[model samples]
Target: MIEKNHIVGKEAQKAYLIGVANRNTPYEKAKEYIEELAFLAETADIRTIRSYIQNLDRPNRATYIGSGKLIEIRTKAEEEGVSVLIFDDELSPMQLRNIEKETNLAVLDRSALILHIFDLHAQTAQARLQVELAQNQYMLPRLTRLWTHLERQRGGTGTRGGAGEKEIETDRRIIRDRIALLKKELEKITRQDEERRKNRGEFVRIALIGYTNVGKSTLMNALTKSDVLVENKLFATLDTTVRKMVIDFTPFLISDTVGFIRKLPHHLVECFKSTLAEAKESDIILHVVDVSHPQFLDQIKVVQDTLKDLKIENKREIIIFNKIDALSADERETLETAWLSKEDAPALFISALKRENIEGFRNMVVDTVRAKHAEKFPNQKLELYS
Candidate 1:
């Protein structure tokens, strides 16, 4: 029996982060990706003792890294007493098995790490059920090997009369049943959301979408003055919150939902489909990007891909470049030049933390929403100035 304390003990959990990229990736970019993996490990409550990055022509089929690198990782892990090895990329099941066999430590990929964080941050019943369903779906494929490993670790006498033997089967059955129940609950919730949307009538709806920890919650609070939870951690807000406000006496609804991350697990997207429906149903999208981050462009692409996956690509969107207060003058100048050079998308730069250019943001959103509304409902004819 694995005690709850075993899972939660800070002293017992030490992690080592690893990142690998092919010759196509620049060394600097690879390093940044590795640092992100470390941030993710920290958010999941795993202590990252070290990080390793390697450039290879291609990942090895068996272990994802070269044999020598694997051996080096094993030696370092043993020396540091690392409990978990976290990879920046998703590993194939065979690669996972190979790494575990070599290192004799718990192994997790970027997807699994994010799921674990979601599991920890989930608070509401809906959010918890969604996370649990996602976790089970992710675990189902690895169950056989995981159970075999568990059996090897926990050798016992026959005094319990095969209770341990049946535990894995019992757990699988429970998880399957729970998954079905959660699906039904989510269906009901979806129907309720549909009705709520219908009742919302002509009010314009906007949603804040962004990379995790890029200050979406802070922007939401600034825009609406609602005290949604704001934190420096990833996945801080799991449940979606919608607030209504009047900008220049024009009523509109804005929603704040869970943030996105690079390579966010497919299971999470599947499970949180209902929550993400808020974005799908919105009239406008406030796509926030952390302007200060070196990987800001990549972050933007991830959010765009996620939005496209959610089938909200056709919706009106304004790129809100956030965290300008943290950017150096040269960096700010570079970003401004980049934005000016781009002619396709509408973009705004602001510091949500300092409340700089918030009024400008609000005005831009109001004007955009009004234009979209007029375009949609030509007969109703709402003027922007009025």
Candidate 2:
């Protein structure tokens, strides 16, 4: 329900990101979320001017921060000419309304920010439909904030006091209708896509997944030699791209799907279920992590939990620690030592951008795929290939 003229324009907004830390969520966790929020804002063409974190045992329940902190933030925002305030967590509709009213500025929460990024990144018709469904659902609950009050026309001063409310109701009905349509459309698309996957001739499918901007697409391209839209920005590739790949005379399919992040909106996850069906149906899951990121372990936990939620936990997995090129010599040794010593799924490090240590990745994938191939197609001759 963002205003078209203001939000969907070329002018990049100056935004202040705020996060609240409680005893349950320490300052470090809130700080990590704020950093991710800034990335989300950048994806939506917003420039974050600064970030503010308040250590409250709980949110203010009205402002999401204390009144004094809100006042301090307002003064700082005015001095910096910040146009909007982005919160690290989702705010209630009342909280959204109250904050905007007090600060006299627009407000976006982490969920809204992620949805906006998805809105920007969705390319194909299916992706667009999925994103629209999520957006409409998010808007439906916040209609009051979306449609502001307007008393009457200048010429007809006493014409209406509740016209704004009526308009909001009308908009809500329209959005609800649109959401219904979008659901049906997506179901049809999902069925069609399912048929296509079924007819793809029983190829081994590998799904690449990781936190956003951590070289998942780079690994996909490097492994399959296919062009995927890769960028340094968050959620750069929203639509799934599947490519047929061959290693050691055994052919399989690989897909690059949307990257995961901390605190992804639950509604978005539901809306993108059809898009994630590829991963759920895959034979192998490549959980790529950026070992270079300071909080890579936290990011890894987030992705693992997401996979479990998606019920993709049973797939044979490979933990790929990517972007060794960004690490110092000492850091690389330390990561390899730590990961290599662990008794878990096979772990390997590579700089996909630099094509480093990729041969090892291929050999493992080849072995994994070959084992599956042998188990499934034992009668098929592979003496020449192996």
Candidate 3:
């Protein structure tokens, strides 16, 4: 159990972040990737004490990083009092076991870290079920490596073919059964949700899709004047929240769905497929980007690739470069010049937090919704400004 206090310790939740740079991935990009990983750790209340990068064509099969580098990291972790080690990439089962044996500290890969955050952020029963399913699926394969923790709990590892192994097998079966039950429960929940969506009766669905913590919820609140929980932490909103939003006296539906991240676990995505249907079913995608982030372009690509993976590449979209209030003068100007020139999908710059250009955003959304509405319901007359 990598508890928050375990991470924060008595004073701070210290951790070491590790990454790999290969022929395709340069050191500079790897550094940025580790910085994002550190941010994620901080979101989980862990402070990154250091960052390590191993420039290998591929990860070391046994340890992920070389044995010599592992020793250096272990020594450094001891010196720095870092309690946890976080890898930027997912570690194989063998790699995880080897690294834990070598370091003798809590090691978490990107998937586990993200799942932990999701577990923390899950509130509603549906969200809880979704996260539990993801966790169980993740745990099923990693159960073998948890013997040490089980032994620590029982105060002994027991004899060969003994209690630890039996307990692990038992836990795996329980997790498998629980995963099955959760899937059924999610099926029920999703049926109810789909019925609810269907009850809305052909409403033009516009969904806010973006990278995590990039003002999607804030923008949703700004647009709908309804608070749906906005936080700075990643994966703050786990449930798909839908609200009836009317602009220009034309009623439509808007969904603030779960945000995307780089290397989001396949298991989690599989679990949340129903939750993600809000985006897949949308008529317009308000692709929000945090223009303030230095790697905003990369974030955009991540969201795009995720959408492509979901096979939802044909939806009409509007680029919403949010948080412009935090951008530097030169960055803001260049972004505007570059994006504003594009004629395919309209791109608008605004700050959801600062409420800058919100009215313009409203007008743009109303116009877009009107156009979509006209296309869907050519004979219907919208009660505009009545």
Candidate 4:
């Protein structure tokens, strides 16, 4: 539902963000969501003019926000000359249409915004196919919003249907067909990927899993010595990148997969499951975390929940609390002590950007990979670096 052409050129599209705070989501949390939503807009190259949050018991079914609040927003947007309204939560087709009609501006929800980001980042054929499938699925139900320009034909004198109705039906069929074709193409690519993995010859596989913008790509680059695209944006690395490395003669494959985010669309998870197969098949998962974030713990839960949903929660994980350079000495010590006391999983605190504790990080990986490599190749003798 979000168009990118306006985002191009010198003047980026200006947008106002909307969020709802309810009994479940307090004002503070809703404010955080709005901030994240603004960041999402920024990543999509949209300039966030301002943000609005309504305190409601629940979101309005028709317009998402209260009528008064929406009116206020409309007036403010007009004063600011913002042409786009981005919602923190995904809206139903009816709600989206209502809000667009009432405000007379471009409307986008969290799901549509994330999908557009994925569409922009998708590079590999498989990644493109996966993103296309998710976009089609998301667009299928929201097709009515696309046909708002066409007037509905009256069924008075033997008319089949309105142009809008007929066009919607035709578009739905085309999207459905496109979805099916994308699925088939993805399955073929999945098979090819599986074959490639099988040919890797029993190397111990380690995959990096984490929340979006948590420095997973930077860490991957640090470890593998490969120049994978690293951007300071959410969902920067959509396609999985795997490289073979030898640490003290114990060779293994390490992969960097797409990062997890809060409120990620269900259709996206389903479509990208194939892309996440590397993590599913890995022997060890390096769950990277940005310790600098205020809600770092919540981000951990989000990743854990996503892993559980993917049925890979049982994998061996090492929680790497990254970006320690952003924390003070006292803060880092406090967090490390508290987290290590939990004794849930092996945790390491380091800064991938600053090359902090890098030797320790390498030693830990070498030890883990050596153990898994021993299991795979019992007859081979590998040297460990300490």
Q: What are the lDDT figures for the candidates, one per model? A: 0.81, 0.83, 0.85, 0.85
Q: What is the per-residue lDDT of model 2 for residues 276-383, given as tens digits with 9 covering 90 to 100?
A: 999999888889999888899999999999888888878888899999999999989988888778757788889999999999999988888888777766777655
Rank ordering of all candidates by lDDT, starting from the highest: 4, 3, 2, 1
Worst 10 residues of 1 by lDDT: 1-10
lDDT tens digits by residue: candidate 1, 266-356: 8899899888888888889999999888888899999999888878878888899999999888988888887879757888989999999
Query: What value of lDDT does candidate 3 attain over all alpha carbons?
Result: 0.85
TM of each candidate vs. truth? 0.89, 0.92, 0.92, 0.92
What residue runs in model 2 are displaced by over 4 Å at the alpha carbon? Answer: 1-8, 147-163, 379-386
Each candidate: RMSD: 3.5, 3.6, 2.9, 4.6
* Candidate 1 Cα deviation (angstroms), residue 85: 0.6
As for model 4, its CA RMSD to the true structure in angstroms is: 4.6
Off by over 4 Å in 1: 1-7, 144-171, 378-386
Between prediction 1 and prediction 3, the one with superior lDDT is: 3
Model 3 poorest ten-residue lDDT run: 1-10
Candidate 2 CA-lDDT value? 0.83
lDDT of 1 at 244: 83
Between candidates 1 and 2, the TM-score winner: 2
The C-alpha stretches of model 3 lying farther than 4 A from their native spots are 1-12, 147-163, 384-386
**Which whole-number lDDT from 0 to 100 does residue 227 have in model 4?**
91
